[model samples]
Structures are given as C-alpha cells and as structure tokens.
Target: VQLMLVNLASPVGPPFALKTVTPSAFIQNMLQSTEERLNNTTEVNPPRILEWFDMSNTLHQKFSLIHMERPLFQPFPSELVFQNFTPLQTYKLPLILLNNDKVLRHVKLEQQESEDFFVVGPVNSGSKVAPGMSITFTVGFTPKENKDYEGRLICVTERERFEIPVRAIGPRAILDFRDEIFFPICLVKAFTQKTHLLRNIGNSQAKFKLHTQRPFSVKPSFGTLDVGESLQVTVSFHPLTVGDHREDLLLHYHTGEDVFISLCGSCEELDIHLEPECVTLKRTYIGLTNVHTVSLTNSSDTTLQYCWTMWPIQEVEEKNSVLLQEEKEEESKGQRLFECESSSTAAHHYSVQSGALQENGTTINCFYIFVVQKGEIWPNTTAQFSIVFKPEEAKIYQHTVYCDVTGRESNLPLTITGEGLGPELELSYSLMDMNNVFIGDKDQYDVQMSNVGFIEALFRFSVPDTTFGRCFSISPVEGVVPPGASQNVKVTFQSSNLGTFSEDLLLNVNGQPHPHTLTFRGCVIGPTFHFNVFELNFGDVAFGFPATLTCTLFNTSFVPMNFSLRVLGDGSGSQSVSSSSQVSNLSHKNWKGHAARVRPVEFTIIPAAGSVRAMSDVNIKVTLCSNTVKVYRLALVVDVEGGQTLQNLCDPALSSEAVSREGVSFLHSQASIDADSLRITLHLPDKEPHQSNS
Candidate 1:
C-alpha cells in the first residue's frame, strides 16, 4: 500500500509525496475502525494516538486519520463563542458539522467534562452524515460563577477527529433603583404615580420580576434588560381609605438577586371650614356701600377650591315683590308691616333670598349683596374676602350665600343681613317771618323739625356765610330725631344796626340728597320819641330872683326813651348842649348888649334824667335864677340805648342878654331855632311870670 503526505512548512517543496507504508499498518487501521464502530463507545474511551513521517522525514503525530481522505468531516464554525449570560441562566447556541468527502461517514460530537458547558445529540452513539451534507448540534452553556468559561467541542469521525473551540462569559445582574420612594399627600380614592429608571448597569443581560402589595403597583412588572440598558418604571399609589400607606416593591431577578424598594404615601379627607356662619352688617345709608369681611379656612392637607354662589336675580326680585305685596296688604288692613317707630330700633322687616346657581352662566346681578373675592385656599391657610351691601332704597335686605368647595358634602351657607336707612327730615315752616324787629332786642320764633321716614334722622344746620346770618340763630344746630317724631327749634333774631334782613338757612340731614333751605325775613327799626316844645323860655327874670318854665317829652315808639336836660354855660352839661349853645351865643353876639355887664346865670330842670314809657309823655319844669339877668340859651338832649337821639334847637338871637341899672339895651337876634334839639332860654323876669311856657 502507498501513503501520501503533504508538506506544510516548505513553500517551494512538493505539495504531495507518495510514501511507502506497510500493509499490516493499513490493515490494522481498518480492523480498529470496525471494532470501534461495533463497540460504539468511543466517547468513553480515548482516541488512539498515531505517529507518522512528513515529507522532510521529520517525525510527527496526528489523530485518527484512518481512511486517509483529504477533507474528511468539517465543522462550519471552527470555534464557538457563546453569548454573555447570567449565572444559573441557561443559554444555547448551534454548531454545524459538514461531511466534505465524496463518501458517507458517521459523525459524533463530544465535549470535555465541564460543569458549565455541555453538547447534545449523538454524543456517545454516532450519526451518519452524507457527502456534502451538514449536521447541527445545540451546545448549551450554564455558568456557575461570574467569570469567563472556555471548553472544547470535539467532532469525531471515522477518518479524523476535529476540535472546535467553545467559550462562554458569566455576567453579573445588577438593577439600579432608589431604595425608598415617598409620595406626597393624596386624597382618598385618588391615585398618584411616580416614575423611576430601572437600569442594568452590569456587563450582561438582566431579567427581573417586580412585585408589590395593595395600594402600590408598578408598570412593566417583569422585563428583560440588556447590558448597560435602562427603562422607565412607573410606580402607582392608590388608596381606598384615609390613612398612611407603606409597601415594598420587590424586584426579583432570574440570577437570584433581589431588591426591595420602600414606598411611602398618605391620604386625607377634604375639609374646609368657614369662620362666620352668619354675617350682620351695621345700619347702612341709602346709596352707600358697606363691607364686611369673612374668612374661609382649609383644614385638610390638600388645597381646596372654593367660590361664592350668588343669589339668582329673578328669585331675589320675586321674593322682594312678595314682600312688597305683603306690606301693601298689611297697609290696606290698617296693620303696618314695618312700623316707623321700630325702624330706629332693632326690629326690621327683611325679605330673605335663597342662594342658588345660575344654569345659563348669566352675569350675577346682586343689587344688595356683593362678594369681593373668591378663589382657592391653600392647606392650613385662611382666605378673607369682603361682602359688600349697598342699598338703593330704604329697606332691610337679607340674603343667604353659599360657598361651594371641592371636598364638602354640601355647600356652606352664610347668612347676611343688613338694614338700609334713608332719613326724611322736614321743617315745620319753609320761611320764618319776623315782620318788625326792634334793634338791640332779641325776637324768637318756635319752629318744628319732624322726621317722617322709617329710619331715624340725623340733621345739622350749616352756618350761613352772609352777614344777616349772624343776626339769626337757631337752637339745636345738630340733633338726632327718631322716626315719626318732631323736634322744636327756637329761632332768635337779634340785631344792633337797623336794616331789613333776609337769609336762607340750610338744614343738612344724613342720607338726604340735598340740604333743606329755610328763609328768614325781618325788618329792624329804632324806637321813636319827640319833644312837645322846641324851646323852654325863662324870660324877664328879676335880678336875684328865679324864673320857671315847663316843657314836655313824648315817646311814640313801642320802646321807652331816656332823656336829659341841661342849660348851656352851666359847669355840668352835655356835649351837644354845650356845643350848640356856645355856637348860638357866638352868633347872637349883639355886642350892643353883652358889654353892659358880666353876670352869671343858673337854671334848674326838674326830672332831668328819666325814661318815658311807650306812647306816653313826661312834663319837665325848668327854673332859672340869674344875678345879672343876661339871656341864657341851652339844649335838652335825650339818648336812648338802641334808638336815635332827640334834642331841642336854640336861637342865637335870643341867647345873649344885657343887664344894667337902667333898662337893658335891646339885643339884636340873628340865630334861628332848629327842630333837631331842645333849647332853653333865660331872661329877666317878665310880668305874670312868663305865663308858664307850657
């Protein structure tokens, strides 16, 4: 028999060379193959080693080359590398063996004893492979530790034994997650969700299964993650009752690794409290807005949304109409619904309107009650807002307001009550007439101020800016009057100067649109008085003798008059008397008579100073005593406190007289008497005692 050997070391050497081999050796190889096939236990027994010689005659060794065929059985993958896998997790891969020769052959696959790697299908017993055909076998790898694993898969045939390298990597399974997750306070029957990253930070694949108890759940409970891969995991907390909730999310991996994530959450019921259930506003004036503030507090852990429900306009109007009808009916029956006397007190007649929501989203027309603010109230916080009440007319307004909140079973009701007052004050007379007023004297008139409105009236008199206003004064300039009651006000007029006075007085009342104007008209005049005679004469008086005369003073006015009499040239006399008599003496110069003698004259007037009664008169007696008997002139003047003065006029012609032993020289007269003043004349005694100049 001949054998062929190929040289692999020498490039230029012969590719194949025939070699001489003993027939016994060839026959021995055939017999050994037959025995191996008959026993079918080559997997248990190791293959026999054969020695051969190469083309260079160098000694070498090869395994199982029985038939000497060129390309016996070949495996397509000369080496097998398993995918990276987790510990204790089975991973499988396919290995294909092909028959490359033109003959049929029996093939078997075997692997070295390794606890982590193994091969399947006809390991001990062989299978037949046709020429140019292939056979596939599944190789599984199971790693026991976290490390790289290598093994050999041997493909045994009748002609040769081929070795295919197999390798596998043991991977670590690591899942990255937060150790604890806390959820915020939530309302009962509501759910809250939290998202976290589930990442595989290891060098191999990771498979996990998540589990949790009640009130806690996770999305993507079980999943597979590749190396360095991550996914979002959502954890939800849904509570059925109000309380604190605690749970653990268990993440179980196929590699026997477990992780626990703590979940904490709480739930609470909705509660919102109102500070004041009823609101009572003070008495408000008509056409004025009064505000009252109220508070809404949130007592729960969650924020609450709240809004005030306004009373429906139609409903309010209907209620007001009904109340009006009732009032009318009561009036018809002679029974007053709201007593005017009670209006100033605590009793009130109000129409209560129920709170309701508008279905059509119409604008709220709250004519009486208005809400200033509405919105959300935070947890453990209080919200205060204004409730304004403005009345258009005098009446009582009562309303119920509802506050609708998120968590309350029913709407909160707030009662608001207010009274609108309009003061109706009137004067008894529009004009106060004092037809004639005496100067420097006070005149008073009584006036009535009545309050006819349902509410109490507050009134004040505005001080007038005119000069005449000072002459008039009204008592009780400011006062409060009850409903249906009247107040008496005394108006007095006092003036110093005489003139016609007229003034408009303003009465200002609360809640009145305009001030009440009252007019006062009057005329002021002085007292009237007159003298009966223009002159008092003591003529032809005897030397060292006395002469007497009489004069009358009259008062025609309603007031009394005061009078005084004095003789000119007297040491004590009035200023007007002295002034007038001095001028008269000068004018009556009569140089022809005054050079005769320088004698003093004296005059005495009875009742010199006295008051004359109204519409009456008083008589005055004037007596003159002269030593030289020269003509003397004087004036009598009267002065009243608040009336014009009255005086007698003197004639300068008769004012000067000459006294001598012989008959006095005749005195020429020039001055004339006037009607403004009372004049006195003194002369020598005349026969019959001047016949009493009465």
Candidate 2:
C-alpha cells in the first residue's frame, strides 16, 4: 500500500507548520517527478519533512516545516575610523566579521576604488565564517594629503549584504612664515626681540621645532599647535660685536622635513650723549680767538676716558677726496688751473706777495683749533669743555673735532664752523696805460684806495722781480686806510730803457687772503735823430793821397745828444792769429772783402766828440787815405751817449734798415748806451770816381 502527499490548502495550521495544499492529479504527478529529480542529485536531500505511517491498506502522514531567519555576515564594528595617518604611508587596523546565524557562511568585502582607505585580508573573493564564529580582516588606510577621508565597505554574503562606513584621520603640519626677517638697530651686548605668529591651518595637530645659532635664540622652540590655532613665537638677538649680523633659522617638522628662514640685524656702538653737539661761533676778525662751551654726558655704567683730537688724517683725506672730486667737476666747467713748482722763484715771490703764511709764526696743523679740557668722564655724569677757534685766515673755517673714548666702538665727531672777516679795499684805477714815456723821465699817477669793509685796511705795495716791475715806485708804500675812507696813492714810473713795458703791481693788504694786482702798461721812447749820409764813397786816389768828405747830422728830438765818431777796420788784406786761440783768423780789414791786395786804409774825423743841439743839424767831416791801389771797406761808427737816435720812431719804413745797419760786425762797445750806434760804410774802390770824400 502507498500514500502520496498532494497539494493541500489550509488557512490555519498547527504551530509547527502553516501551509496551503490542494489535491490534484497533475500536482501529484509534478511532486513525484520533483522527488525523483532530487533523489538523483549528489547533494544530500533535504530532511524529510513528512513521515508516512502504514496500517493495513490505510496510510496516515504528518508534514512539518520550520521557518527561521537567514544568517548574517557582518563586520564587528559598524563603522571604521583610522586616526593619525600620515600621507603616502600605510596604516592598518584590525576588523572582524561575525556570523550571527547557526550556519556556515561565505562572505566577501567590496569597497570603492580609493587611495586613502582600503581593506586587506582574505576577504577579497570569499571567506568562510562558521556558525557562531567570526572571520578577521585587515582594514588599511593610507592618506595622500592632510585631510579627513570617508569611505564605505560592503560585507557581502550569499543571503545578505552589510555596509560598514570607513574613515581615516590624516594629520599634517603647515607653517606660515616669511622667508626673511629684519631687526632694528640695537646696541652691542643688548637684547632685542621680535615676535611673529605661528599657526597650524591644517586638519589636525602639527608638531614643529625652531633652531638657531649663537647671538640668536627662539622662545618655545618646539611645540605643538591644534587645528586652526595660532601661537606667538619670539626671536631674540644678542650680539657681542658691533657690526652687521646674519644667520638662518631652521624649522624642523615631525615628518623629517626642514625649512629655512633668514634672520638679519645690526649692532651699533655704545650710547654716549653730547649736549650741544655742534659749535658755531660768530663772525670774528682774523688773529682773534672765539670760544664755545659744550658738555659730554656718559650714559653707560662704566667710566670712559676721552680725549679731544683733530679728525684723523685718513678720514679727513677721504672726505677731502670727495670734496676735491666735486670741486674738480665744478672747476671743469670753468678755466683750467696749472700747478706751479714751489721751488721756483716766481712761486716764492707769489707766495710772499699773497702773504700765504702768518707773520712771525711757524707752520702748525692745529693752529686754528684749541681744546681746553680733556680726560675721563664718570658714568651718568656730564663734563664741560671749551673749544677755542683761532682763525688765521680771512675766510670760512670748518673743522671736525673728534673725541676718542674707551668702551666706544668709534670716535664721536663734532663740527665746528666759523667765518673770519677782514677789510675790503677797492681800487679806483685797476688798469693804467701810460701812452708814451720818455726814458730817464718820471711819470706820476694818483689812485684812490677806498676801504668799504667794516675794519681798517693796512696795505703795502710791492712789485714783481722783473725789469718792467722795478720801474714803478709807489709813495707811502705802507699805510692804513680806515673804513669808509679813501686814500690817495702816488705811483711813479721811471724807466732807463726803451721798449714796451707792462707789469702788475701787488697790493698786499693785512688780513686779506690774496693780494690786489694793479696793471700798468706803457712804451718807453728816446730822442730821435737822423743823418744825411748813410755811406761814404771815396774814388780811387794816388798812393799816400788823402780824400775828405762831409756829411750832415740832424737831431730832431726835444733833447740834445752827445756823439763820438770813430773808424773800424784799416782795410788791410792780412790774416792774424788771436792771442787767445791757436787757429789763424782772417783779419778785420779783410772781412767780407771782394777785391785782393787792398792796402791799409786810414780814416780821420774832425770834431769827433761833440753835441748836436735839439732840432738842429751838425756838419761832420770824414777823411780817408789809402796806401795801396785796392778796394777798401771800412765802417765809421758814431756812438751817442745821452739819448737814442730813434730814426725808426719817426719813419716806420726805416725800421728794418736801421736795425740791420746798427748791427755791424766791426762796431763793438763795452759801455751800455741808450741809443744804438750809427754805422756808415767807407768804400774805396779801385776805379776812379767823379767825386771825392770832403
């Protein structure tokens, strides 16, 4: 006997099973086929839910199905958070997945592609979790940047899927600092501090440290800052030397990275105060002293030894060099100046004329300055001192007095300035031109010297060491002229020579830096004269016969002239040896001779020494005798003693000819004369002539 379970329907059933079934031939056939298919499979058949009972051709069956919840594969923690994760570095934490149902389950973890958080374990494809047991996995977080990261991981099982939130806490350090820092001027061995703000503008806490060298320090060198928080950092500088200082500050981070910052500052010398730091005196006369008082106060705790001295030569020369360069640039726009040799007499004369040196005094470098007090000054005390300005020149004076003190880095400079005043003298006639002046005669000129300054002027007159300069004589060479007054100075010019003369007479006034130059120019002339005959021609005469000729001399000047006539060169064709020389020389008689066998010639003049009256003529007779028949050449030299016979002065055309005629080779004299010698040639040719010498 066989009983078959068919589809049945029941709205309500026992507590163990609640199902609906229906009895049908088709449904029974389908169930039978499904049971056959299930029995043929290798899988274990499901537990028999129905039991059939047999009783003599009758069957009783009971069906029961228990329905229970499916198992869940979930991570132990619902959410995951990774803290203190460094960027580009891997950080790991443990995670667990538990199976809640009483069954063996296979689970897998799936997460979105991310760089910050990831999962690591055997949960990539599948992981087996027994009933009432859990499987472990590794949750890894690697942050690339400094920020918070959020993610989700899916725990997938055959029957269920679970979501787990994942997060990573990334911490970073950021510093906002300037690349360079500068500090104000500070005294040596003093402390100066500067404050700056250090903030962490990141997602988490930051750790940092500040490093520096000697003479520099930082407060709170290493510390931590919270997110969006700021901290004040103070940098202190203490310098031991006086000068500029530079250093670098390093900022180290916990991530093994370093940053550099530059620090710079300057340290000056000790602080010493001087009351009335400058001295300025009123306008005073030269050769007088003006005094000014000042005080020096020490502000430091130590006593300082101080001494007043002139500015060091090195510093002075440096300043002077700059001034000289500026002066040269300014002077380049004007006339050029020439340097003179000090050893030259002209330079010495100029120095004397200008009174470059003080009278009856030796040269001194500190002549214009004098310090009354020097030594040491106690701490927090003031010492009074005096500065005497003795001006030796009548001009502006400027000097820098330096005080050298102990415990000071450099000397203190104090400027002293003053001006020296003197009399101002003006000349009425600066230039004088005496048109014509006769030799051995004096000419007078009067000039008014006025003193326009506030003081008296004591002036002395001098001349240069020149021929024309010596010709001028000033009456009352040295005298005093009061202020707003004028003095008449007599200038007399007397010359013994004849030429154009120009000179600058020096007027040296006391307290004046430079002398006043007065210029005078004139032409010195002499008496004028002329002769009727320039050459005397004598015809051929018999041996031992005498020939005489007459010529007239005219003196057209305003003065008389004393004259003497003589003959040179006897016209003998003979060569003789000079007593001072061994070589033979052609005799004077044969000088420039064109004919041969010229016999000795003699010349005689009547009234050889005489005077010609002014604006009058005088008759002169010349007699010649030849001993041989030959050409004779002689010069009749007429020397005048009182005045010059200026023929060229009256006639401009005769200048060259007169100079050439006066320069004769045969005429020579040792005594200086005012007038040039007149030369008349005596030519006795061999040919006969129509006229004979008178």
Worst 10 residues of 2 by lDDT: 1-10
Residue lDDT tens for model 2, 62-160: 211213222254344444556544578776655566555565556677777886677777634464667756677778877777566888776665554
**Whole-structure CA lDDT of model 2:** 0.61
TM-scores, all models, native as reference: 0.34, 0.35
**Candidates' C-alpha lDDT:** 0.59, 0.61
Candidate 2, 538: how far from true, in Å? Answer: 24
Model 2 RMSD in Å is 27.8
